[model samples]
Target: MRKLFFYTKQQFFNFKAMQTAAGFKLLSMSQLLSSQKVGELNKNQKYYVDLSSVMGYTKTNDSQQMLFEQLFDSFGENIDFICDKMYEEDIKYIFRYIFDDFSDVDAASEEIIAEKETIIETPSRKRRIVDLNDKELDDFFKVFDASLYGHERFKEEFKKLVTAYRVFNKIGEHKILSLFLMGDSGVGKTEVARAIHKALGSRTKLAKVNFGNYSSHDALNSLIGSPLGYIGSDGGELLKRIQESDVGLILIDEFEKADSAVFNYFLDVLENGKVVNSQADEYDVNGYIIVFTSNITKENFRSKVSPELRSRFDYKGMFNLLTDTDKKKYVHFRVNQIISKYKEFVSEDIPDGLHDRVVCEVDVSKYKNMRDLNKKIKDTFVKLIGA
Candidate 1:
């Protein structure tokens, strides 16, 4: 009963915190809307959002959308109830409504502030991007270390990254620190990209893209939008996202499998620090750090490319191979995680020396190393349980 009450209180506190946050946001939104000049909108624009329809739903939208200017204005102070309900569609609708109202109002201070906050609150950064300064860079590295299990060499490479940043800053030029990270699969190349996204202090970033997906014209078009009269409209997914963020990271995995045409697109970005669109305009890529990963070797790549094409990348480094001790550590680490996860699912104590038996019994040679050990265990579990 005490634990239940404690949990209830914790939930209450969380709700209260969320309420306060929503209240502040609503207040800010209100202030911004009122302060901006909506120009002829107040007299001419017909509000298209349906307020009664939104309220009929049981929840408020996390998307923070509202229709009708009067609706937002009237309920500005009471928006906490709306945001607290996780009604994303409603929130997005209302948000776009508010933005539309502000944009019609001449997109003044209120509109700018509203859009800026909306961008910041988005899962990806929208625009007016900022880069990590030296002190923030240090904090970023610190968090990167804390997020992972083990990678002493990764930490060392990160220090080299700090030096790289300093070099870029001193040169008064904005160009990517291009890196080619080659290693065995699941050895943390992907994880490192995620860490950089979390650490780099940039509002705009992406960590990974598989080269195999870029086979069709639509696939390439999906990254950056297509020309007018295209079936559906997107702002060009990857390219626009990167441009809007200003400073971001792009982690391209399995580069060897990407179509040659994709490399043709990338050549300009690597050499000139710009991505040219179909419209003939250029997006500055100097603000980005592009990391490409592949299992292919230099000889194979050279065979595939001309000498001029090979010269585009700035830095290339091999991912470190795991040692025998490292492999053992990974095995034990995974075993502990599995035990902890399933301990509650089973009522009785685990079978005597079962973990040890499993670890000791598996034929390690059928797969690569520690990474395979976990896969083998998972496969074994699936076979036994029909999972």
Candidate 2:
């Protein structure tokens, strides 16, 4: 009969010592029991079995206790069962009842001792987001109002969305708030997400997935991933971007450009508030706000998007071109920003009247598109600075 080994939780994760001592790789109990036969070992070879998963299984199914005992016995001398100290008594009793000379091996080998001195440390992968207290939520609204310009109706609706999300997050069935914005290009459709990210005080880049780049046949695979056992099957661009971001907001720009597969995938995501990659790993986006920006017209939107998907959006609104007054405000904001940056870095003093001069130079009436307005501001700034 093989002796059962009890390890501390710390020791179980120390792969080098465990692998060398057992003369085989370590595997969780679930992996060993799974139907996949890719890495199956022969009868004579030994393997280290992680008992944590076994403990969880046996706790749920009292009837499986006898079956697991029989299966462990069948592995015979080829398996070394490794478990944490808390499960020692249960494991000991199960082994003693099945085998006559069940005992634990307590002696530490010289190799294990040496390997312990050089234990490989793994970096933690814990994700953290900026959490707002009640006081902070009020401050968040103040910042949001100042940063986002124009579209007063949408702004009011967004505030209501945030308030509802905070109040009902714990009890509501819907876990995510999804907004669909459709309008002409440069109408601040994408800016809505930028404003929210800034209001959250996020220092990291906003999580963005542009569907304009994913119009191919395998767009779903490129967005999530190919299935396991296939090439390039790692968590795809969307997951990677989300993991890198500090805020719980995702921007899908040019949303109408994606294939139907991508649309269906997102419908499932909006419904469940979770995204499952092709590898079967799931990411929780419970408190997230996903904004979809599109250039599709109202008529095309109804025709292109299915009714089921269209109905899932929490708010669907068309963003209009910024009013002339809003454009003037944006011009003043941009000029001030440029002047502030120049004052901070340049040794030469900028003229006190430079902002007014630059704003006057930019004829806002000539430009309806925000992108074109922004270009004019940049051009005027350069000309004034050079003069």
Candidate 3:
């Protein structure tokens, strides 16, 4: 059986030596037809190459793709394809067109070697959950509980989870605290991350990635960065956001909308407790909280996501619509905040009844989502101030 060499760019030196020792010639797709030097090839000789590097999923011209196809048709049997950090299906997609007698479903054997890890270290502002002291952790929880309305049960569960995580994490047991929140849209699903960000006392934006935009065929490239140095050659949105944030929290919005490649990539992140970006920069997220929010129901969550991934979550809970009482409390809290801001910025001569009058204009039962309720509160404030 012929062995198809699959190695990462980090292990290129080993692959180059091993392939050259054999009869196979090592040639890039660019060097195959584009190079000026022409050499006569012996019949039945083998060659190692990256087929999709020049003939990529996107951006490669029709003429270039046709050239690769013709090259494959001529040397399909005489070629041992080299895959650089690419999935097997992607490699097969290129081969599907050339070989009509393609019977090797799983013939590509991965070359397993000791990988030399490449890390791009930057001065990062990393304050992990494990770093917080007792009083500081209490302060964080206080802010977290106050910022998010309702979910009393979830808050209690989260407190217990964190208390245990702190102990286990200190002993090198637990790595990451992951939450899979399944709920309806606008039901304060993302509010969990916002509350955590506020509680962390960060002076910067929250680290968030909306997977709705990552549902494309090349979603993985956009997320972790494209190989061969496209836009995300520096490690995609995930690494960039993590690097920029001071807090040890990551919010992945619309989790169910992401591609399977993304799902597989995150599986590794959760298992390893570190993010190795496309540029090979290694960032430790051991004490981080990665919150994944999805609008999918309990049934879909089971049928859609894989079981291996489903078991990795520390907590999976559903968020319900805020009760009328909770909503009223939120309205009051928001109005009081607006009044406080107005007094500090615009005028401190506001009457005491102004708070109650503003709250009275709004009916919480009219809205299902907190966003709409917030909008109603804003409109009432504007109208009352105009009067």
Best by lDDT: 3
TM-score of each: 0.52, 0.65, 0.67
If both were scored by TM-score, which would come out higher, candidate 2 or candidate 3?
Answer: 3
Per-residue lDDT tens digits for candidate 1, residues 1-387, read 000001122233332322222111112122223323222122211122222234334244433333334444543221322222333444444445343221111112434444655656342343211355555566556556643435677668767865765577458564666667667676666656666665553434564567666765555565556765767755565555554442367888887776666677677677777766554555665556677887777677777655665676755556665555555555554554455446536643666544565566555445454456678876654343332
Q: By TM-score, is 1 or 2 better?
A: 2
lDDT of 2: 0.72
By lDDT, highest first, what's the ranking?
Answer: 3, 2, 1
Task: Give per-residue CA lDDT, model 2, range 1-387, as digits (tens).
Answer: 565566664444443332432234455677666323313443434466767667766766778776666666446465666667788777666556553443333334556645633432211121112246665566556556656668889989988877776666658666788899999998888888887786665556889999788766878898888989996578888888887776688999998988789889999999898878887877888778899999999999999999989998989999999999988877866676566556557844876567779888888889878999999999988888888
RMSD, candidate 3, Å? 28.2
Q: If candidate 2 were superposed on the true structure by all CA atoms, what would the RMSD be?
A: 25.0
Question: What is the C-alpha local distance difference test score of each model?
Answer: 0.51, 0.72, 0.73
Instruction: Report the number of backbone clashes for model 2.
Output: 0
Off by over 4 Å in 2: 1-131
Give me candidate 2's TM-score against the actual structure: 0.65
In model 3, what are the clashing residue pairs, if there are any? none
Candidate 1 ranges beyond 4 A from true positions: 1-118, 121-130, 133-135, 143-155, 183-188, 201-207, 216-235, 240-247, 279-285, 306-309, 335-366, 369-371, 377-387
Q: Give lDDT tens digits, candidate 3, residues 1-387.
A: 233445655566654543332223566665556323223332333557665465464244545556555555445455666666554455455555653332221221324321111111232335567778886788678668877888899999999999999999889999899999999988998998888887776545788999888656867877778786575365789888887777789999998988778888889999989987777878889889999999999999998899889998999988999899999878866776676568658996865467679888898889998899999999989888867
Instruction: Flag regions of model 3 displaced more than 4 Å.
Output: 1-125, 229-232
What shift in Å separates residue 10 of candidate 2 from its native position after superposition? 37
